[model samples]
Target: MILSQKLFVATLTAMFTFFILPLFFVEENANDYFIGFVVSSVTIPFIFTFGLLTSMLIGNFCHKYHLKKIISFLLHIVSGVICLMIFAVYIFITGGSPEGYIQTGLMIALLCITVFFYIDIVMKKKSK
Candidate 1:
């Protein structure tokens, strides 16, 4: 498959696995937890979709400017940092003591890695 296709699949998979699955697995008060999980699951797709779309825009901009390598590198770094920040916020908002905060952090790290890979692929394609 093309790199863009791969990125879309990966992004969707990451969103479902890292964000949605946790809602199913994490422990909390049954009613409140269910409500929170439902809300989060619904909202996460919007966030993920927005990020993916923005990444595509960034990739196109990089291609247009013939600065793919630099732009990709910068984007990966910024996105990774933002992902970390999101994890921090997730922890803080979820009562500052969610059971799976560590797992969520790790997942965010993995997502950052995935973002880096996508950025690298974009840079390589632009160079070619």
Candidate 2:
């Protein structure tokens, strides 16, 4: 399979297995169900859309400015941190416990890092 296609499939699988699966394992109540559904339906797509847009912008920038690998690494680290902050906010809004919030936020950060690594690998292969 093409690298991009493989990365896309892996990303989608991670999104479903790691993010969506948690909602199912959580206690199901009216509010929880609604919140989980809305988050899954809306937020996940929004994040993906934003990521796509960001990737496009990065691609353009790299073409024009010749960004170094270190710059790309730094950008990914910052993006991962920002995503973790958003996850924390979501947990707070949903009234999740501190421990739950922290754990989930960390998991999300790790996922974001994984995605960044995958993208970097694909991009590197393309450049070669």
Candidate 3:
């Protein structure tokens, strides 16, 4: 179940970042689909790899310490902010456009937070 939750969070993050968010920022071009495909090919794997790592770390930490709901929520928020900072630095280092970095960074943060929340919700339901 924990493994499934990790995969779910990674997949959800990749899908939203690759498919949905681009709709708002990318310009229409003859090769736009191809470009998107290329980008996703690169990014999806990256997200999955890191997403799983981060999610597992957080999940294990929460479980090990047996955190309360409010503390867990705060921990997730801090994780999100850390993720956002890392993402921002990554984009800057990669020379990605400034215009898109803010949105991408925020999306990354949201995705990080969503991972914990989704897992918590699912675990709650399972326990019941």
Candidate 4:
């Protein structure tokens, strides 16, 4: 995929994972948590920036070694792990509650995988 497509995917995945997904997972203080997330306005950009940069680096590495199929599958896994780590760090840095961490982390991982795979499938179909 091109850089532009990667960036677009990153932005979409970040937005969906951080913004929309949280609404369903956060049981307590749903409004407050979401409000805090929106008010901070830092999480989205942070996720998107790191997600984009890391995916790009991984893409380049995969291309360099000509491990397209293996790396493509690994890329989704890596992205999910990277996103989970970023979320954990962000939560720690902000002193957010640990209670919802697992739920949110799982959501992030699943969303990342879903979005990346969906995009990959669509792109492949388009190319074919």
Best by TM-score: 4
Name the TM-score of candidate 1.
0.47
Evaluate model 2: give its TM-score: 0.54
Give the range of the ten consecutive residues with the poorest summed lDDT in model 4. 17-26
Error of 3 at 42 (Å): 1.8
List model 2 lDDT by residue over 1-128, tens digit each.
Answer: 33464448446645545655565355757887777678668666766666555555655576679997667556656666666677677777888755665666566656665665566566558767
Preferred candidate (lDDT higher): 2 or 4 = 4
lDDT of 1 at 81: 56
Candidate 1's residue-wise lDDT over 11-121, tens digit each?
A: 655655555555545566699777867855865665556556666666677778888465665775566556557756776797786456556555654555565465446
* Candidate 4 clash figure, as a count: 0
Candidate 2's clash total is: 0
- lDDT, model 2: 0.62
- How far residue 108's Cα lies from its native spot in candidate 1, in Å, is 4.0
Residue clash pairs of candidate 1: none
- Estimate, for each residue in 1-128, the C-alpha lDDT of model 4 and write its tens digit: 57778776666666665566656644676787767678448765665676667767776787798886656667767776767776677667898865566575676567676776577557646768
* Candidate No. with top lDDT: 4
- Local distance difference test, each candidate: 0.60, 0.62, 0.64, 0.67
TM-score per candidate, chains pooled: 0.47, 0.54, 0.62, 0.66
Q: Show model 1 residue runs off by greater than 4 Å.
A: 1-7, 11-47, 97-107, 110-112, 115-128
List the candidate 4 regions with Cα displacement exceeding 4 Å.
Answer: 12-23, 26-30, 68-70, 93-99, 124-128
Name the better of 1 and 4 by TM-score. Answer: 4
Measure candidate 3: CA RMSD. 3.7
